[model samples]
Target chain A: MTKTRLTRRALLAGTAAAATAATLKAPAIAQNAPIKIGVITDRVANSAMWATLMGEGVELATKQVNDAGGVLGRRIELAWEDDQDRPDVSATRARKLIGDGVVMILSLSSSTAAQQAQTATLEGKVPHMSPSHSADTLTTRLNNPYFFQMGPLASFQIRTLMAYAGTRFRRVALLTDNSALGTVNATSFRQGLQQGNIQIVADETFERGVTDVTPALQRVRAANPEGIFHAGILGAEMALFFRTYHQMGLRQPVLGSFNLSIPTYLDLVPGLLEGVQFIDVYDDVKPEVVDFANRYKAVHNKDPFSLPAYGYDGIMLTVDALRRAGAPDREKLRDAMHATRNYTAVIGARGTTIGFAPDRRIGFPENGCVVRTIANNKHGHAVWRGLAAS
Target chain B: MTDLLELAVSILEAGGIYALMALAYLVVLRPTGIINFAVGEWATLASFFSVATLGWWNLPYIPGAVLALAGVAAIGALTEQATVRPMIERGAPILTPILILLGMVVVYREAAALGFGTQNLRVPPPLGFGRIDLGPIAIPMQSAVVIAVSGIMLAGTWAFFERTIWGKAFQAVAIDRVAAGLMGINLRLVAAFSFAGGAAIAGTAGVLQAPLTSAHYLMGLPLAIKGFSALVIGGVGRVEGCILGGLVLAACERLVMRYAPIPSGFAIGVPLLLMILFLLVRPTGLIGARGRT
Candidate 1:
């Protein structure tokens, strides 16, 4: 209302003041903006079945974080890309996700694809992790400081099972499928058996899509092994093996890999897998798992399985780092994540935690995996814990 | 002797599936001259449909399975109607249709993946999940039914070609398309019929296998490879060749791997080796195409 001087100096000064004010407000608005995290999953491939549940866990945790006032006053936003279970595709997708400003990545695809995506993650200096129950090559094949794997390795399951088998049975046969991971598990199981001085009577592998496994089963029975160590990952192959075993009236106790922990096998051949035992990273009565199952059911209207719990653990680990990071920054979060210790996770045994004590890249605790027995034809409860199973 | 008998029974069950798939390829290849690698996807889609209708919707098993099969046949007709007819009208090369059919493989697989997700779905065995203990000849009840079904389909397809007027029209077109057209046979109609008929046979194979393998989208490619191998081993000429080739291929796969003192991986190579031998020695297969140019 009070007009003073119409000088050019006065007008320039006012414009500069306005510009400075906006500059000051920018970081505050950005601080309140959602921080996007990248998620690479195999949506339209064979791994999609596992990836879907893991993705749901990530989404649930994201929603819960946002609802509880976000991390460091900034909400978490997940950018999703389906890798199609291809290694090259996952690498390209990782670069694309990084370009889109994701501070971190959670790979929920196949382990091989996740391993390849580490190429981009290492180059981009983006913190990446696979919260899936997976193979160990992601940590062993690369020395990427930014990538972390939070699951028991394929070798860990074998050692644990061997420890459980102990002197109880001196002769054991190993049966596996012909898939790549199946071969890796077979090598691990064989090494575990040989190191324990257990007699390997028969080592057999059936083809992936082969409908009949009677020939392989007959060979195992002929060897007269006291027990059978099953390294089959595919549902159909495992079902065929069980059916043939029952048909032959072989009474050897069967020990299986963590892959059998998947609930899909419950419906494959009912009444065939009643007393089978397998290795897993879950104890049904653990407080953290119990809480997670209750919370998941409260929202999803069904029970949460092992896959979802691993996913929830992955995101929570990321969120914890972000909280201590004090900013939505890739570098700061990476440093903060590297410094994490003794995180109370929803996976593993009752007192098992998520901490990278000796091995930095492999975040799962040494004693995290447990051997569970199938009771009443389901992955019922954990009966043994630790690396040696004793 | 028991091992040999069990191995033979095993061969029959696996061979039945491969035979059905080979017949599907032959049925389409006869009139259209297109190998239709998508036949495996057709089988895969039919299995997915049956599992959804029967498992998820809890529909009565027989009606659900038949309806799913009919649905796949309709898709086959629509596929030919949409793609092949136009391409033929434009006089695309024979290799062009083959390439187009390959693209349809992706389309069908992605469709099932989208509709069903990535989960392995089960198709309740129409014969139920049990075994038939015929003395020392104990076999799964589903496998016995599958073998019977395969036999009936093969017999019916053989009779149709040997006796029916439509079947003769198909043979005439396969031998001489232009002459068949000159004699008042509809070439387009035969093409559509072959695709629909091929889909029905392949879909039956898929339904039969769903109980064994648990139907999945990734299942199509492996089966397509095996089916093509069976056709290569058997011959493209006579319908019975499909069964003979299928059984032979199955025997080579199971027997050699089970009894042979070599690496198990070599067993997979044995069939491929036989296929190469057949292609080089006698390209017409075990039964040569009579009027095939």
Candidate 2:
């Protein structure tokens, strides 16, 4: 009888120990399972650099998360699809990612492509975010609850720049190219100027191909406004604009849209952009930014631009939502993403954090825009970070 | 008056580049009567070659430029042999070669984009970015270099067409292809020479202008349109007419933008408007054929 009781107790203890060991092994097995995420990018387009920079940030952030044991005990796996910056291609890629069973999708393409991808995300009920597109239409054009935009909208950029330059110049001239984005940015800028009661002394536009901008510059020179607002986004056209502006000896202060935040200009338009201030979302002096830059450079062997911060924040935000949801359930993830608040954004001005309200899908704060100066052919420091109401 | 002087300088600076492209169009159009829109793509290809030889390999400007232009000329000859010659030898219509050249434009652009990617590539100016002042008139050194080089090229081209026996053969072919063929001039050889010369001129324009605009894959279409407009405005008959058309088109474009009280964006329409006006009102163009009577 004593031997039988001892054997029964041993069996009970052994069963309980085996059950605990199995429970621990379960998570490790799940951790080895890859939680696939999809990234739609423009690998070959006019805006390839921006796409590359954004994708680099995503890759860097994804590595960091996996290093930290990943979300929900699963390693994050990124499946990439090149959109070629075409809207149709972007939509098709988004659907294909959904079909491939990705938990979420991140897009870093033009606003048009991003907006098109929204249709696929909405139909598939998968959460989607665009980290670099600035067009306001991405959120407003579609009531896709699963879609979110993180970049500063065109209106926000123009308004922020106007607020920064308030009372500095009563009359300002606008210079932009005929490219679609340039035209759109210029129009938003025009509307902002009109609302500010500022006079536009001259409005000049140049084509993408013509190297000579002097005729347009001559007209602007004749008008002789107190300042010049550059809304052109094309690198070659903007280079022509600055070269012409410098050659014509125009002394008026030149302010630019947020497009200047692109780092390619530092190399493309050297020595021509000094003394020019452009609206940006990055504050180089921020500690978080410095840390991110260091880590990114260590991994990529190159300095990180402000644009990458958006991509980093995008992946982090999605992972944070995933962590809160604790499962790959699309509905729960969507709800968690929509509830994001007080999250620290690596990009944007000081004191600004990314959040999405119940009513709004655009995640960037109103005060996130900052004005940065260019000096010695490189982006300098933030000159102004406004908290004024939009 | 300063504005006027500066405007004139802008015209010259722009016209110089446009003239080179217009002349490229004229070269092929004169002898073959086939409008090769691929000249712009040839220029863009040369720009990419410059980026490789000059920017990547750190070659000196003169040798780098000669290599790029020569490479494009050879490519042009290959293109003629592969696409144009075969089609013509098969008794295809004149429109067949034109259409084939159009197809080559897309092929060349895609090849460059695939090889170099779609980023804008920067080439340092042959001269530094400083400006040279001619009294009250100031010109960027690159612009002045472009003007000087284009002037020499245009003069050389004029002499080639007028003074050289081979050039006279091209003119004779332009006047009447059947008569020139009847006169024992090899049509195939004439076609190859025209394509080679045209491609070289276009490539020179690309190498010179790449510093200003950066060599991009998408730069070809706009250039092709502008060059075609220049051809339409200057007339296809004379080499000098091509240069004259480029200058006039550039001048009118600037002058209208400067004094027309039109919105700055409207200035882009000036070239298209001029092209249409020339096609509708002055189809023979500003300089018609020398022996039209």
Candidate 3:
């Protein structure tokens, strides 16, 4: 084992020497032999919008990094593959990216796809980082040290939202659609509510394409819950719920999950979301986030949301680890990535930094989520600063 | 008391769209004996048209809706020409056209997705947002509009079958395709018209419902399933059966949501469960096809 380590170190040293001698300028290195990072994203599945935004974030960050002297004196190059939102295809894409000599892989698809991609990534021993997959089981399902997760965990989101909810609501209703992600969020929210000893007065679900959510909301109103937990993710269904809620004239405050963190709802369900609070990963109060938003808008000519920040942070974090590793070796880079602590990204709550303990591979802290409420149907301002709010 | 009134309005509003979707399926099923799952996609397409006209162009609701429905009807005729007529001409099996239409469903969705991105396009309600009072019942304006529209459509459909010669021709063709052909009724014309009407009906549903759900590519499948289930529950026979099936399905689903002790997640399966139950117990549905006599 000692000899193997020595040989690996020697090989890495020789590669580093060659990389240094190849080019003095980062652009020259980019033109010649640049460091490659693979990104797996869903381009056409249910989460396509989220994936596209995240991919754009990755691109913007990579461009910025390459503009400056690239990581470890070599320019950063990205190899992107569409997983098509299928787990099996994601696994195949992971193998393909590894074959293409990607030093590390960043996944911006569903948690299922990210988990499946880890199978190939684990075998290849390549470091894989999922920027936005929050399922707690992703890192726990496999004991692969090569994989790391860095998003607001479902548990974290639920806890944060519930914390924002406080003791003001004794009896609350849980609302979500039948979509898989919505169902998962509802289940997680239920567990969080139970643990917090909050009484779930009503639990309701509606089909996605239905014209009305009144029956469900009426039931919720009948139960006379103090507040309603909106856990549904589908934009259309959520709009229906809000509209029905307003039409029914129910005065209960609505608390939404991280799904409402998506800015798409601001446009889709305008006027109906006034005073409704939802868990958010993006905090405008953060200097880093302000800088990211200003730069992103200047580049894309549009306001940047949190979805892209997840991708941006994933690539930035990967590069940070590579810079620390000082070489293109996979094992060394994995160790460097796992050692990350207090690294701030554009997407979390103010004062929350990206950190991973020795045993835990999930990089996002439990307190890194905030609750934001919609006002005037345009802006979603941060209402509760962080999860620490009682 | 107010909650129950609101619930009744909600059920009526939902059932109206379901009824229209069921009628769309029944229109094609009656004469062609083919289940065109593509009606759902046609509804999705109409929603895009509404988005273009109503949302983008800021057209009035009536004109925008009419144009969208007309566009969908043309697409239906074109689709029948492209997919159905050729298969029928070659004397393909019944399943062949059904499967082909199923393939068209994917084509329509992909076309929409490629044309309009995966984001949900905002669709404003036709009569604007808010509520109206019909005596003691407070109903959303959009829901009230939906009920009115579906009533007109059902009335129109019933009148055509009962009052018009073309409607009798359609009935003749549905009764016995070969016998109607022998009677000199143009089967091709009837088939094309049936599909066009079906598309128009489906497009109407999409346009009316778009205010609530918005225009989306993935929105087609759930509608197709729910509409198909309604068709099965109402039976493939009469126009009234479609309305009956839709109302019954909506009522059952809503009641389950309001009262079922199960998790709300399980309530979503009520429609499917009802469909399965109907298929098992009353395969002919609540109202089977109208007799030939």
Candidate 4:
């Protein structure tokens, strides 16, 4: 009887060992199947160094996921297309990526183009994430289940800026361009100013390509506002504005939008750009910012712009959802992405929840805006943090 | 009043640049019936060459300017031979040749952008730091140089067109190309000369304007449009009309800014308004031929 009982115990132990082996080997077998993802961006190989950095960010994120055992036990493969920074081109690229079997699309750095991609993604039932476009319409008017924004939209930045300006100045002047993006930001700023009970002394606009703003500055100077909020892209006009404003001796504090942070603006205006303030979502020098910048610089021989961080975060988010879903099914991935909550990203707010409600199409943590001043031609310490009251 | 004076000075400066561009248009139009849409691209290419010569190679400014002008003149002559000759030989429609010029413009702009990245480039002013004080108003030495260059070029062009035998030959071709061809004029040589002179003037404008506004791919488009407007206002195929029209349009734009509460883009509309008034009063343009229209 004792011999029979010992034999039975040995059989039971063998069965348990087999079960453990199957459990471990099953995941390894499943992981052998590669998971393919398509990324569409404006980073044409022939574009500026910034576009190359964006491509590197996507590649790095994909490699990291593959290195750490990819989503749903499958290695992630990234397929990319260049949108060339055009809306129609991006839209077409999105459609082609979706047709080519991509689960999601990543966009280049403009709101107009993102909107086009979002429309294409929604129709194709694929998720679209924009890394650089800051237009509020992407989250508001065009919000959909397949669309997500990883960066603060323009309305958020403008509202935050207006609230901050209200604390210091009573009267303000605004100079904007005639572009749609400029109009939206200016309108949001005007609303924010009204909410803050700040007086708008002068409101003016110029054409996008105007080489000089002397006449516009003269009008604003006549209003004698204490500060000027310039809402325009970094182009010939900004250089003209600085030269004209300096020549005219308009000493009022000048603040610009994100366009001011562009490296081109720094190169063009140089010392004249000092004291200008602008909003930025991420700064590379910040310790909290991710390791992607270092990796990007190592690979591309240049510092990554704010776009790459968001691109890295976007791909990581998609991978995390796929991992959590534990399947290559599109429906499961979509559900898993929507269910994302308190997800941490390298560029996003730390210790913050990232999820989407059924009514809300975009992930939230959208409330961080850092006001940076150009000190000695470098972005100085943050003047304010967190979301300012609208 | 002081503001008005400042506006006037700005207008004059802008007008001077437009005048140089208009002279380029007049140079080609007077010799050949074809209006080269590639004028802006030629100027942009010349400017990039100037930037390369002066900024990259560390060449002296005067030699760099001359080299840029000479290089662009060669390019202009080559364009006439390679592109214009083919169209003319094929007996293509007038618009076909014009469209070809437009395509050349795109190619040249893209080529420049590819070669020099899309970033704005700064070119050091030829004139040293100095400003002319007109009482309370101060104008930079660069502006004075631009005005002086425009005057010199305009005078030189007038002498070349009106005083020299070659100038009469050019005028004779403009009056009757077939008749001048029958009279043993080398039509191809005249076309080559026109391209060279037009390109040199454009190169000069590019170098002078680079200091005030940085050089870039898209810089020439707006300037070209303004030049066309000046040409239309002055009357097409008229040199004196182009100069007068450019100055008048610039003055009107500045005056509108000084007095009217107009949007900055709408300031360009002032010239259109003047063009309309000129069309009504003098249908041939401000200095165009009587009863030609």
Listed models, DockQ each:
0.57, 0.45, 0.56, 0.20
Which candidate has the top score in TM-score? 1
Give the Å shift of residue A77 in candidate 4.
Answer: 5.1
- Report the lDDT tens digits of candidate 1 across residue range B1-293: 77787888888988988888999999999888898999999999999999878888889977888888998999999999998889989989988888989999999999998888777777787777677887777777777888898888898999999899988998999898899999999988999999999998889888888877788887777677778888998998668888888888988888876888754545667667888999999887887776964
Q: What pairs collide in candidate 3? A: B237-B289
Q: Give model 2 RMSD, 1 decimal.
A: 6.5
Weakest 10 consecutive residues, lDDT, candidate 2 chain A?
A24-33
If you superpose only chain B onto the true chain B, what TM-score does each candidate give? 0.97, 0.96, 0.97, 0.93
* Native contacts conserved, per model: 0.43, 0.63, 0.72, 0.26
Higher-TM-score candidate of 1 and 4:
1
Pairs in steric clash, model 4:
A31-A73, A134-A154, A342-A353, A342-A354
Candidates 1 and 2, the one with greater DockQ: 1
Q: TM-score for every candidate vs. truth?
A: 0.93, 0.90, 0.92, 0.86
Q: Sorted by TM-score, highest first, which candidate order results?
A: 1, 3, 2, 4
What local lDDT score does residue B131 receive in model 4, on the 0 to 100 scale? 65
Q: Which of the numbered candidates is closest to the native, going by highest DockQ?
A: 1
What would the TM-score be for candidate 4 when compared with the true structure? 0.86
Best first by lDDT, ranked? 2, 3, 1, 4
Residue-by-residue lDDT tens digits, candidate 2, A193-268: 9899999999988877876888788888888899999888887787778777787888999899888888777676
Clashing pairs in 1: none
Give the per-residue lDDT digits (tens) of candidate 4, residues A251-347: 9999877666666666665677788888766644455464766777777787665656766777888888877777776677778787787776665
